[model samples]
Target: MKQSEIIKRLSDKELKKQVFLSQGLLLIVGVGLSFIFFDTFADWNSIMGWKPKQILFYGVIPGLGIVLLDIFIMRIFPEKHYDDGGINKRIFKNQSIGFIFVLSSLVAISEELLFRGVLQSVFGYLIASILFAVVHFRYFTKPVLLLSIFSISFLIGYLFEVTNNLYVTIAFHFTVDFVLGLIIRFKL
Candidate 1:
């Protein structure tokens, strides 16, 4: 499809649902590819290491936690969610500060380890960052947004590089996200 056509499809609720489903399918494809190419879905860990709890807590949960917290905060302080520049239009843009903090911590810990720690270190930062940003492409379109994604990915990479401890980056990520969450929550 042409770019405009693809964009139009994305705007359609049904198409958007399909896109979300396709993303899930793509993640399965990725896991399948990893198993085929690397011989282990765990990337050398036990096969069961790739299970839901590990992936969810390590990745999706923490980030989502902060996001939800932000939403709760926004219920009280609506202005907290608004970008003065009005650029943020992601689903969680109206989230509360508490929600953002929890989500940030989650993203920092899980995303850093997943992207920078696992993917970047194993493959390369450029590739991993691109993939990371791509997975989140629904949240933004501007070049600046992409740049921001890359910047955050690099910062996470730096944390991993400096300490070689996934938890280090996780901690840093958690702290940053926690702070952002709080800022959004209380409007402080």
Candidate 2:
């Protein structure tokens, strides 16, 4: 079956359910790996480096900047270059603002926890970044989309490396997803 066909067959509720299940799984794996890799909970806590100021400066600012850039690109480029089989629109367009916020938050936290928090911490930036891009398999057939995901992954991984703060990455991830999800929801 074709990708578009598969996407067409999936209802919004089913897509949302899959997202929740996958993200929940990622959260479990992230937390479990952190426990296994770190000597204690304190070690995991230390790496989180949770600071409000840092999250604002390092995460939110950069995330919004990226979202703005993406919006600009979407305007300039043809829609086909950025299309993801309408998955994002389908998942978000009919949702309430609160639901979008919650869904985006879940995605950002779960993905960053697994990728940047655990994988990057255990392995390295390059491996984690590549894996991050690879896991977004829907983008593989579109060069522009694939490159964009890779670049975003690399940037997020680099942010974590420099700041040594999972919160920063989580905030950054959340900002991007939330703002873009809003755009999709409002058809902006």
Candidate 3:
């Protein structure tokens, strides 16, 4: 389909719904892929040597650190780092902050599971992080943001490599998304 055709058929609300649903679908696909390849859900934690409780401490810690790095970059180049290239128009035009929060959590968890947990675990950090950055091609024009994304991807991947805990990475991803979602919602 042409860009114009897609734009015409998908209003902002419709696009948001599709994106939200697609993210959920990605989670299922990621898990399926993991199971098919590894055949051992139990090994998820063993990969990083992590426990459930470690997620609470390590996830948020790394997430918060990334957020601070984001803030620092965005503050210096607000237009470059903060702009979404009309993504907010497709999502949040009609939705409430609560809805955005829910979506953000879903996106974070799903993305972490797929990227850090599955892809990184299978392919290693360098390749997985590259794939993660490539997927966020929207940030390409904004060099600082693109670099930040790649860096964050590596950090999350590194955390997973060291801790071997999906929950920890999920926690980090969720925290970053939640706070950043709020900030963007409020334009803070």
Candidate 4:
């Protein structure tokens, strides 16, 4: 079967919601696995370059970009309120400012540790990045979505590769999520 046919098999709303939930669950599992067996949480200095300014630039900027991107996309496409019951609403209600901050920080920090630090440093960036994109597959619908995720992940991984600083990518991830959270909170 063609890839697009397979992609179309899942309803858009179902795919979006399922992917969002699945990614969250996977993150929890990944963190659990990391803590239980791997001793994954090493000193930040070991993985990141010690530069305070970078946090503002890399973290804050890309984070804002993501939030803005979401707004722009939604403005263009403007999805209707397609809830599968109260599930989506409940999820959003529960996931307010505090939830956004905590989750974003956790994902930003943890994803960097798992993907850039453990996987890339141990195996290779190319392999690790592909894995990262694969895990995020549920978050996107089109093959282009996969391409974007893969590209972004690889670029972030490459930054880590070049700078030997997880801080750079961590900053990027954190900033993106933080801003996105604020956007949601403000209903902007």
Q: Each candidate's TM vs. the true structure?
A: 0.47, 0.96, 0.83, 0.65
Superposed by TM-score, candidate 2 places the C-alpha of residue 77 at a distance from the truth, in angstroms, of: 0.6
Write one digit per residue (lDDT tens) for candidate 2, span 1-188: 98678768887788789889989999999889988887877777876876999999999999999999999989998999999988998889968999989998999999999999899999999999999998898998887898889999999999999899999999999999999999998889
Best by TM-score: 2
Stretches off by above 4 angstroms in model 1 are 1-102
Ranking by lDDT: 2, 3, 4, 1
lDDT of 1: 0.52
* Residue-by-residue lDDT tens digits, candidate 3, 1-188: 84446755877778878887889888997888888768665666465554666886788877787778777876788574556566754575546778877887898878888888788878888988888888777677777767777888788888878787877887888888877767667667
Winner by lDDT between candidate 4 and candidate 1 = 4
List model 1 lDDT by residue over 3-96, tens digit each.
4356554533454355346545654555454555564534434322334444444434544554565456446555533332232233234566
Candidate whose lDDT is highest: 2
* Candidate 4 C-alpha lDDT tens digits along 136-168: 654355444555577778878877876678788
Who is ahead in lDDT, 1 or 3? 3
Error of 2 at 117 (Å): 1.0
- lDDT value, residue 158 of candidate 1: 54
RMSD of each: 8.6, 1.1, 3.0, 6.4
Query: Where does candidate 2 stray beyond 4 Å?
Result: none
